[model samples]
Structures are given as structure tokens and as C-alpha cells.
Target: MLDRRNMLKTLGAGAAGGLTLAGAAEAEAALTAQASEALGPYARPWSPPNDKDPHAQNIVALSDDYFVPGRFAGKTVIVTGCARGMGRMAAIRLAREGANVVGVDWLADEGRAVIDGIRRDGGKAVFVPGDVSENAVCDRMVATAVDQYGGLDAALNNAGVMDAIYPGDPIDYDKQKSLIMARIDQASDDYWDVVMRVNATGVFRCLRAELRQMMKQNRGGAIVNVASVAGLRGFGGTPSYVASKHAVNGLTKNAAIDYAPYGIRVNSVCMANTATPMVERAMQILRERARATGEGGGIGMIKTKSLLQYSDQHARDSTPAEQVAVMLFLLSPESSNLTGANYATDGGFTTY
Candidate 1:
């Protein structure tokens, strides 16, 4: 009988941790060797495995006694950014629990495959491939949920992008830290516009569309925006990304207030350093950069350390699955009393 605390301990211990000189040395060598494979377009062609079981990626097996299945059963959900990473996983998890899912993303092939995989497993889902930055696309996304699934009950606005040139390096610890904590003057207007368009404005459009649909039904709904730990605090290198996420937090809070009377709840999930496709890709690039500069290879180590310092109990931050569980809880009726919350899934990163 693992208590909740113990269960978290077991899981977090597996991935959480800060850097040790010895450990960083070893990790740097390994990461450097793999850097070549990581350099490419940000989008990974790969999707989550499981055309056969669809729910095979379930971190906690359904058979586990502690597992309470189908919390979202009979609900309709619109999951943007469904082509890969967290969005793909959440879409699958909800459908497995009997929710009808409408998955939207710009990656048409991958997005359709996600839907196909869901349908193959007897879960209801449809893919809408579009950019969330456009208002019309957002409208069509919600409309798909209504037309296909009858109505929308919830949404996860998880699609976002960083600056086209997200800098990472193999520089000294101090320099790396300084570079990451980009000063406003260092960031260009172009960088700000690109990031804000997708991360902030895109989410704004989705919230408006989803809220309208939810309001029309008078049934109330829940929304969970995939904000980053950057949203909660400033980071050095990526000012635009940080600012955009801050906007997400604001939209989430204000929307929660405006829609509470309508029974709609809005919240954002603030993740510190979750392992996702985007992060992995960036890590690869950083590893490559470190090798070029002849740094001691603690680049990856320090980033992990940053996350671990805040969450002493865990070696790393929350998993996409763990984050999804929280997102599900927020969207489900179970969180009826919770609203306007920026739930930090940062492994305690903000506590200090």
C-alpha cells in the first residue's frame, strides 16, 4: 500500500535531481555523443507508440488497484497541439477513459495518426489540423468538437512554440545562466512577436472560442493552459517566451473570473522542466553547443539542478503523464471548487 507521498517519492526519485560534478561529467559525455542525432527541425517525425493498445503508454497500469479509471468518461474534449508530446499523450489518455476527443494541431499527418490510433482502440476522436494563431482556425476547432462529439466539455490549450532561434550553449555555468536569463534589450521585436503570437495570442483565441461554446451550452467547462515554469518567473535567455507565458497566466486568471458565474473554470498548469519533445530537442542542441565550446559538459546537469533545487524530494520535475493527471483532475468535476489557479507542476521549483 503505497501512500500518495510514497508514490510520488518513488516516481520523482527516478527522474529528479540536480547536478553533481561527477554525475555531470558522465551525463555530458553521453549527451554530447547523442547531440548529432538531435540537430534537426524542432518537429520530431515520431509519435507515441501504441497502435495496438492505444493506452499502453499509461504510466500507471489500469489494472492497478489504485487506478481510478474513466474520470472523463462520456465527456467531450478539445486538445490542441495533439500532434506530439504532451498533447498527444493527453488526447490518448482522455479517450481511453471514454471521452470523445477532438485533437487539433498543425501537423496534419501526425495529428490524423493520433486520431486513427484512438479510433483503432475504440475511442472516439477526430483530428483538426490548423494553426491556433489564426482566429478562424480556433473557431473551426471548437466547431469540430461540437459537430463530431456533440459538444465540448473541456479543453487543453497546450500548443506553443519558442523563438525560431532558441539559444542554448556549452558555455561556462555562469555564462550559460546569463545567456538563458536574457535581458529585454537582447531580445528582438521579431522574437517577441513570433513567441507571443503562438504562445499568448493563440491561447487567447482558443480560450475565447472554447468559452463561447461552453457558455452557449450553459453546462460550464474547464480549460487548462499549458503554461511553463517560465510563466511563473523570469528566465534569462528567452525573454519573449517568458513574457508570452506570463500573458497565458494572466488570461487564465482573468478568464476564470469572467466565466465563473457561467460555471466555466479556467486555469493554467505551470511546468518547470518536464521532459517533452521540445525540451529534448533543445537539450540536444545545447549539448552540441557545449561540445563546440569545450565546456565541462555540465550544461544539462545544471538545468536539471535548477529544477531539482526547488523540488528536494524529487530528482526531476513532473512527467507529461503526471501533468496530464493534474490537468484531468482540473477539467473533471472533481475540481469544481478550484478555479483561476496557476497550478505549479514544477516539482516545487517556485516554493523557494
Candidate 2:
């Protein structure tokens, strides 16, 4: 959840550098008093003391923290790939927290599910179908959020894809590489260009547009890029996935540093595989590998991580999307002072 770089940030969050779930209330009281003197007695909801319980109850964990209604009420948030996975999760929950949600994805059928879920919960959200890799779509999405929801407060650059074709255990590392290269070789120049363009450059495009709007609107805002752990380390044989993610990580750090003066906070989530469509396919490949090798794999490591069994019981023990969303909150205004950081949402995968 927190890395070495986050040690200082986490330490600053509680009494003597640590606090339990039960200690949040007490820790917040003290944090508030100290923060007031330091930040000049402001009552920003996203401020540190309030960070302890932005909502009454942690929506992810019922009856833990009281739900704070409308914490992001009237604020606009744009999430790409809102049709499914973590992006959908973030959008729906943010809407529940009172943000006007903009859900953009090329898959209308699934995207509509996200919008319906929001509306069903009495939350506001709109579904926009388009290719996020396209600048036109990106621009339309921003405009839609502003025009429909008023103005933007936050954006999650969460759209991306891995090689759907190469999903074997150990990735069959060499075979996967050869296939990807062959896929490129047999394709039109634009095909190879588009794959990298969409996954990597498209992120920069979104960030640039989002930053411009935030700056021009004169509204201090937050942005998150959904990069993967692939970007941080050398993956077995996922060349394009790894390279694109590396670019995402680089973009996030650079943007965070550059946008600091503009009151824009940018951060990225380095996540491991989850039980999403993309991940499931990868999991299947790894499962086959496991069958062949006769070795059990962990929850996230499909190929050969034996930390935990790959069963329902085991996944319940791993980190969930909501936990990663919490990291998003930290990088947002609730963590006004934190920026340029990558939070690992991999249930110790990164640490290990």
C-alpha cells in the first residue's frame, strides 16, 4: 500500500508516524490542531484532519467510517475506461461521494452499466462512448464534463490494454516476445504505432488536456494515471505493455513536478493484475502454466508467484480496488501536500 517514499507521508499522517483504524478519530483531532497552525486555520474538507474520515464510513468497509455525503458534491471527475474494471469502480464510488461523474469508453454496452449503476445509486453520471486514444474523444470528454457537470475537479487516466494474444505462463517469455514482434512486423506501420500511441502517448494527451483545463479554469485539481507495475520493473516478456507503462510512470512523475506550481497534483498507481477481463486472460495463461509446472501461483502473479493459492479464498485476502482508490484520495486534495508519488496497490507484490 505504502512504499519507502511514502514512509514520510504516512508518518506525517498520524501520531508518532502510525495510527490504526480505531485511532483515526483521535489522531485526526491532534492532526487538525497542528495543521491549523501550519496552514493558517483553513477548513478545506480535503485537509489532513478531515482526511482521516472523508466520509462517515469507509464505503469499501461498511460501518467503519461514517459516510460523508457529498464530499465531492458538485465536483466533476472524468474516468477513462469507465466501462469496466478499476476505472468503473472509481467512477461509481466517486459519484456516490457526490461528484458528477463522466464515464468514457468505446464499449457502450458495458459503459452504460457503469452509468446505470451510478444513477441507480442516486448519483449523477453520464456515459460517453469513444476511443480515449483519440484526442478528439479526449477533448469531447473534457468538454462534456465541464458542460454537463459544470467544471472539472479530478481526472483518472485509467484507459490502457496489454497484449491480449500473449498470455502464457512464464509468459512463455520468449514465445510471447516473438509473437508480439511478429504481430508488429505483419501489421501496417499505423498498427504498431497505434498500440504504443494509445497506451502510452494517449496518457500524455489526456494529462496535457486535463492540465490545460484545470489551469485555464483556475481551479486547483488532481489527476491520477493508472500505470501498472510493468512500468516499474522488467516484466517476463510483455515488451509493449512494459514499455508503455514505463512511459506512463515517467509522464506521471514529470507532470507532478511540473504542475506543482500550478496547484495541480498528479500521481500514478502502480498496480498488479486484478480479476478484470485483461487480467483474467493473463490469469488463464498463467493457470495453464501452473498446471504444466505443478506449482501454485499467488493471487496476482499468474505465471508463477507462489505466495498464495489462486482460489476465491485467496483473492479475498489480497488488496481490492477500493484500497487503490484510497491511494487516489491521498493524492487528491485530501492529501493536498502529497504529489509526484507512485502508490503500489499490489498487496506486497511490489515490495516482494
Candidate 3:
């Protein structure tokens, strides 16, 4: 068996001493990490999600991006942003566990892929085409689940745009002026609005509508929002994504508190960088910068080296989307009493 300490030493070896040319470069790169301590958008006085699952059977929680069978038997679930990446992965996993899954996405083609994959695996899933930001669209998605699955027992609010990420470095003196001119310059006001509308506001709308229906059912429900590691921390690059998700965390706590009177459980799956579309886009942008600057030069060796390094980190940052879904199950009746918690599905990124 490999010793964890030695393993980490090996991993951090390349990043050692700031002596070699490579080490110096990585050290400089390391300084790009932000230290800003923005507060979490809101406080939690709410119920934790899936606080109910662990007691039902001998079922166990997944540690990585993997799953076991029957994790969510006899449940009806709605997953937003199921068109691609983690959302799609989660939707498929729920269906495989014998839940009726209602998937929503803006990407029609990718949405269909999720449905198709679920069906291929002998699981039930329905793809609804639309944006989660719109009340009408959100309403319709929920309606599809109720209309088809009898009633929604759990809803995973995983739909949201991840268009921004920290650049790992703050702006230099040359780039500081324009940034200082605007309060939301790093991510911009427009960027903030767009992200807030889709990521944070979408959750508010989704949970509000979900709770209203759950209240009508007079039955309890569980909800999980897809927040991020940045939500737990803060950002100097894409401040908006961080801000929006932090608001989501607050929304989860508040909703959990309000809805608990009616037995509704609300929580969030706060993740990190992962091999998702959002991270891919961020990497491409960084690589483009490297190319444009000729910093790493012709072969793009240094650029490739750094990009792959960051890419691997982001990939390791998140568990498989399905792995996080297990927490959603625990929030339901299976676990029996958990509520109002912010579960970190990050690969220890927040521990730092």
C-alpha cells in the first residue's frame, strides 16, 4: 500500500523550493490564488437535505464519483441542467436507482442524450426543454414530473451556468485601472446579473415553486442546489459565479428553515472545479491567453504543461455528479432525519 504522506510529497515535489525554472513559475502561479474573504450570502436556519437516508438500509455513502445500486429506490426526482456534465450524470444515476427522473436543460441535444442514456440503462427519464431561469419553464419542468411520476419527492436544482472561474492571479498594474473603475469589474455587473439570474435566482424560483407544490401535497420534500467550492470561499477572477452560488447556499438554508414546518428539506451540493463544460471553457480561455502572449512559445509546451496541470486539478476537484446525488438520497426518507446542511462534494478542495 502506498503511504499517503509519501504520495503527497511526490505530488508536491514538482512544486518544491521555487528553485528550478519550473518551480519558480509554479510558485508565481500559486500567488494568483485569491485571499479575499467574502461572506457567504446568507445564514442557515433551515433543515438539512437527505438527513433521512442512512437508517433505511445497509446503504453506504459514496466517497468519489461512483455509486452502488438502489441508492434512491421508489423516488421521483427532477434534475435541472441535466443536459450535460454532472447534471446529466446525476439524472442517470437517479433513474438507475429506480426513481422517475425529470430532466431539464437549455441544450436540447445534450438533454436528449441524458434521457437516452438513462433509457439505455433501463431507467426512466424525461427530458424537458427550457431554461431554469424562467418561472414558466421551471413550472413546466416540475409539472412534467408530477404529471408523469405521480408526485415529486425530491428535486435536485443542479442547473446553472458556470461561465466564470478565478484566473488564479490578480490583475497586474496594467490591468488594474479598468477593473477598479467598476465594482463588479472582475466578473462585471452584466456577468453577475446573468449568473445570478441563472444560478442563484434560478434556485430561488425553483425551490419556491417546489416548496409550494410540496406544501400542497402536504408531504415532505428534499432539495439540493448545485453550489461550488467558490461559494464556500470567494474569487478575484469570476466574482459573479462565486457570489451567485454563495447566495444559493443562503437560499438553501433559508428555504430549509421555512419549509421544515411543512417537512421540506433543503440543502446544497457545493462542488469545486471539475471536468465540466464550465471548467473546460475556462481552461480554453487561459490557454488562449498563453498562446496570444507567446509566454510558453511555439510548441506551447509550457502552456500545455500548465493547462493540463490545472485541468487535472479541476477534474479532481469534483466527485462524479452521481456521487453527490447520494447525499440527496440521504436527505430523503431513506436517511430519515438529516436537514439544513451544506454538503461539500468537492475533492477536498475546500479543506485548503
Candidate 4:
């Protein structure tokens, strides 16, 4: 990927705008020819050749062309919770970079839409509609990779849920925050059960299935489990969520050690305050709560600091793509030396 990018950069730089059109064209051709000779042809695997077909054109138009292709060429990947947000973004990005994605999610319509988008972009993908919290579904996810793509090369276990306790009113941020910050005694058994089952146990099932398959393949593969910054420390407020994430972190570490001999690298990306749909809803609630209080800084003042220790530019909330970038790194061969590591993509939120 770096090589291809550098070659393109060199080619573009050679086409000086100061030169005449014909001269510039000649320079570009010459540079391209040199690059071909050195790099054995500049291949654009991500996009098909420009043709008169309107369908192909539309697909190209929708495709993310910014990524360097062939990174995961000939690889089959399984992405959980790929209907939207981080999971959706990672699945599409992986497909764009030449991976055959097996996306699993509970939302059938949205999951199919994501798969359709990948197919429209000339990328390979298939959607499996199911809840990851079930062991059968987790097994099926791994089975789909084998049945459809022959074998699984990698997986991004990005399925997890937060403990949401709403105090009746949707717009009342104070009540919402109170419910969120509720202590253990204030929480119910169902609340803890749902969070742990989905976030921790669901991941455990997926990891087991993936590891078993990778071991059987004997080719070795990578796995990146999606954890949260809550796993790293006790920030209070959401006890179930923090505990679940901590369990995920521990599971990632233990699996990494157990599977290292088999060449299966296991790691987790701990993120915080990413601009996901869940976070967006939370922010909106906070904003409304601030308005209701209408005092000298209510939830507004603590909103940012609530998630992070710092409020500087470096500590800004990350986009879905930003988190996926680190996940890709961990899944790729570039991170072969990195295993059993909880990579914090927290944007300095955990620095303190």
C-alpha cells in the first residue's frame, strides 16, 4: 500500500502544472512508465476500468476510492454488528481494500444495505442476519466464512452494547444522566445481564468460533476485538458497561496468549467518545438536559469532560473511520509483532 501510494505521489508530482499541457501529459506518461518498470505495473485493484456502463460508473462513484487497494486481497473477513456505525464502516473499508467480507448483524435491512453497497462498489460481501449474543449465531458467522469464502482470514468482533437506563422522559437529560450514573444498588439484574451477555459473553463466543477455525486452517489469522475505554479504568456512572468492557479486555489478553503458538494474533482496540449513533443520541440528550436546567453550565459543561480527562483538540471525539484505521492496522500483517496488546485508540482520553 505504501509503495503504491508513493508511486502515485511521484507520478502526480512529476506532472508539473507550470509546464504546457502537452509537456505535462508527456511528463506524466514518462513517470508512469518508469513507475511501471520499477513497481511492475501500477494496479488499481479497488476500481474497475472506466467503461460506458452506467451501473459500473455509479458503483465507482459511491465507492471509497481514497484507500490503497490489495491490502487484504484474497482474504475473507468476518465483521460483526456491521449494519451501522463502526462495524459498517470497517466492513466497507475492508471490502474496499480487497477483502471478501461476511457481515453479521441483527438488523436485516440495514445489514443487507451495507452488503449491497459493497457489491455496488465492485467489492465482495454477504450479510448474515442474527444476534451475536447467541452461540449458534456466532458459530454460523464463522461457518458462513468457510462455506462462502472457503476459509476465514480475519475477523473484527465489533458487536457490543451499552447499558442504557432511561428514566421515562427522552428529552430530560438530567433524568437520563441520573439513570446512566445510577450505582449498582440502583441497577437491576436484567440491566447487568443484558450488558454482560452482549458485550462480554457474545465476544467470548465469537472469539471461540474464530479461534477454532483459524486453528483448523493452520494458515494463521488476525482478530481485533472491539473494546471500550471503559475497560481500561473505572469511570463510574455505567457500572455494567465498564465491567463488561473490562471482561472483554481480559478475554482478549487470555486468548492472545493461548493462540499465539497457532499464529493467531488477538488484540483489542479500546476507543472512547467516538461519533457513533449511540454517542450522538447521548450528546443530544445531554444538550437538551442543559437547556432544561438553564443555569451556569449544567450537563453542557461536563459533557466533554465526562468522557475524557482532557478537552483539547487532541482529545476530540474520533470518527468511525478513525477507529477503523487502527483496527485495520491490527488485522493486517503490519501488526504481526503486536499481540496480546490492548491498543487504546482513545484520542488521549485515557492518557491521564
- Residues 124-237, candidate 1, lDDT per residue (tens digit)? 799898889999999999999889878999999999875544322232533333333234765556657777888999999999999999989999999999998889886655
Off by over 4 Å in 1: 1-67, 165-183, 288-317
TM-scores of all candidate predictions against the true structure: 0.72, 0.68, 0.68, 0.73
Best by lDDT: 4
Candidate 4 accuracy as TM-score: 0.73
lDDT of 3 by residue, 1-352 (tens): 2222233344357557435777656543332221112112222221232244422221122333233345566778888888767777778667645578999987888788879877765677888988788999889987888888788888888887644232233434244323211125334555566677888888888887787778888878788887876688755455667788899989978887888788887877776556676566555654554554544333322222222223232223343543455555654576557677777766455554
Off by over 4 Å in 3: 1-66, 164-183, 289-315
State each model's C-alpha RMSD to the native.
16.6, 13.7, 19.1, 12.8
Q: Write the per-residue lDDT of candidate 2 for residues 1-352, one digit (tens) a residue.
A: 1121233245356656557766766444443343233222211233233344563221122111122334576788888888777777777667655688889887778888889877765678998888777889889889998899778888888888675342222455334432232223333343345557767988988887788889898868898888877788766535577788899989989999998888888888876655566576555555565565565533323443312312222233233354445645853567888788777765456665
* Off by more than 4 A, model 2: 1-68, 164-194, 285-320
lDDT of each: 0.73, 0.65, 0.64, 0.75
Q: Could you tell me the lDDT of residue 98 within candidate 3?
A: 59
Global fold similarity of model 1 (TM-score):
0.72
lDDT of model 4 at position 183 = 52
Error of 4 at 28 (Å): 15
Write down the lDDT that model 4 would get: 0.75
